[model samples]
Target chain A: MFRPFLLACAMLTVSNLTRPGLQPVSFAVEAGKALAIVGPSGAGKSLLLRAIADLDPNDGDVSIDGIERRSVPAPRWRQMAGLLPAETGWWADTVGAHFTSGKPDEASLGQLGLPGDALDWQVARLSTGERQRLGLLRMLMVQPSVLLLDEPTASLDEQSSAQVEQLLGDRLAAGNTIVFASHDERQVARLAYAVMSIRDGVAEPPEAVP
Target chain B: MSQYIALSYWDVVLAAVFLAINGGLSLWLDLRLEKQLLIASVRMVVQLLLIGIILKWVFAATSPTITAAMAAIMAVFAAREIWARQERRLTGVWGYGVGGGAMVFAGVLVTVLALTTQVQPDPWWSPRYALPLFGMILGNTMTGISLGLDTLNATVHRERVAIEAQLCLGATKWQSMAPFARRALRSGFMPIINAMAATGVVSLPGMMTGQILSGVDPEEAVKYQLLVMFLIGGATGLGVLLAVGGGVWRLSDERHRLRLDRLQQTR
Candidate 1:
């Protein structure tokens, strides 16, 4: 019954996120800004991302624009503020089944380096890189206000990775806020407007991208 | 129908011969189940004899309290059996309550309907008809709930990410879990469907066979069996529905976040 106004300038916000093995972490990214989270494996980058998305249980306040996470339901919040997990899960047999609108945009599919006929292919036959790319495409199809991407290009080859970065840049320019976790600092240097580094239970306040 | 010949004590021994032969095969094949077979055989006789004595007393007395108590006790056992079979369950007595309550609800509904309608025995609560009918319905319904719950748990565990993705897509909790719930219900109902399909072809069902052996008219026996099967079908549908429903409810928090932690992993 509670319909929110269409969020323009998706201002990503997080406060006091406390989950197991992670300290209470907080940060905010201005609208259209990309915040890169860099940490070693097992450093709780994924946990923090999940917490911010309200996927896992954590004590935190996460909001997009002025709308609080608790104000809307978790399902609605996650839909408006989407999280692409490290290893994406596919439940349906074909690529088309994942999308609610029946078919993913063929042009966007090409942008993510997927063939136009990719939607017709069985999900089981997808290579890890293909799945990863399609997973991002699937998340992007919803056009969430905020995006939590866990290594969006971790499985992509260099050429495909460039395509993804360009696609994400296009989305961010369209006013999406992003928090992505990766060990790739060069990528951070390339795309991030701010950076949050985690090491041994320590999290830095958001710093301007160096 | 002609009068049925009663089985003698020697006839009981003739039944035991099958058990003896099974034990002998275990011994010869080194399957190492001789002690287990021997103990099961002994336990069977003891348990059946004890139950028989109790049932005899129950039938003679015909007290509603005692009848209800017996059914409740059986229901409790069936519920506990369902709880034990589930690898993941709601913590504490909730699992027991969900499983037991579903079976009891379905059983009572079916039983009361049958008694007031098709099966109006002389005393209304005739142990001869009520006990067996209730037992059969409860047993089958309990099996269905157990299967339904197990499938629900496994699906929730296996498809957590996919479900969460759906939630991320603005789907309601029910929308996210509806497909899995349907699958679990199918798992639960498949056995009953198979039995229905195989009835009279694969094998004569138990109630019909027993009634025929007891010198009931074949037509009368078949009719009773058919009615019981229909009642069993309704009871099973309710059982699986409630079990899967309760399971999915406990799976997620009110915030619509998946609370997998609420389910204890028995594996």
Candidate 2:
């Protein structure tokens, strides 16, 4: 049984590199744990996430729970390994239309510290903070196995930032793996169970903490 | 018929006035291009006069072959304009594809009307009926195709990440670029929509005025205008949709990622 599994794994590794730059970079994201990536800008932190989520061109290896990322179809990969970019895109006219699954109702809005009637609010009227909060909430609603966030709270105020951290903490406690990129050392210290600092496209060894 | 001639002359004079106004404004905006404008006006007058003389003979001869040849010539001119507007050295393959595709698509539709509906005096090619109709369709399709290609290329460059995201999500190459493709197609057809809306109000259309000038009854001229408009709408719509859609397919690779660098270099 183990022999067949190993062969299957080898085959997956080969197929993942079919596109020149589509292979996932090797980084194990444990279930129920949060891994924060700290790096200078343009260090390929966001690109790494994109690659794992099959959103960027790459060549290497990537797997979720030993299942090769490339073996899974892209839609399934996106649904399973969701990436929340620094600036989330809202395609619909109203806030309510952004959510595909859950109702964008008063309770959900209130949870995100938004006005109850935000569901009816036009996207143009929303501030950057509001848009970011809505983007986070939209990602949460998807209930993916892994969450890849690219500086999700870089733009929010301290109070709003703390709220977002708390929300992520709650989700972490409930057993979801998150890999987020940030340059903020304080945010990294607060949220990271393990920190991987990336430099010039290379992921450095994780620092051990007492 | 006498009344129609009077109306045609009146319409032509109004068109000339409008052209003069536009020309004056253009001159005011850029005095440097005055020479260019003069040259363009001269070319237009000479070309139209030549076409008029040739068409007079075509109408007198009333041969289907000559009529078809004239239609083909119009298509060639339109195709050349499309190529020049793109500013790309379309390899022979692309040239054949764009030129033949646009011509056949527009040609078949126009042929059906001219042959079946008896729009012209002759069964196959009535220069009076076919030439003008062909010119309108060819001109519109040329603009549409150029706009479609330009919009498609621009969208691909701007929305690379979104397209990649969609592609990674199991969208085929066509599926990945579908949004941009749709946008291009929309831009291509927008002018046609504007023309349709502006018809008979902002401008008196060319065919109606011409028919009225050349001794056709006002009511009869109006009918022809309506028929031509509908035909144009149908022919151009089909031609542009196919041209843009087919062009997009040719632009990408088997992987579905747009060849951005290649397209950029060409531009």
TM-scores for all candidates: the values are 0.94, 0.71
lDDT of 1 by residue, A10-128 (tens): 99778887888789988889888899998888888888888887777788787788789889877778877888988887778998888873456568787877888998999999999
- Strongest candidate by lDDT: 1
Given candidate 2, what's the lDDT at residue A104? Answer: 54
True contacts kept of each: 0.66, 0.15
The pairs that clash in candidate 2 are: A21-A57, A21-A58, A21-A59, A22-A58, A22-A59, A23-A58, A75-B169
Q: What is the C-alpha RMSD of each candidate to the true structure, in Å?
A: 3.0, 7.0
Per-residue lDDT value at A87 in model 1: 86
Q: Write the per-residue lDDT of candidate 2 for residues B1-267, one digit (tens) a residue.
A: 555333365676677776677678878887566677778977997898798789889889887787788777777677777666664433456744763486468757765665567564545455665676677767777787777766776676667655554443344668667777899889888888898899999988888888778888878978878887777777777777887776677666543444554443463
lDDT of 1 by residue, B166-243 (tens): 776667788888999999999999988988899999989999998899899999999999999999999999888988
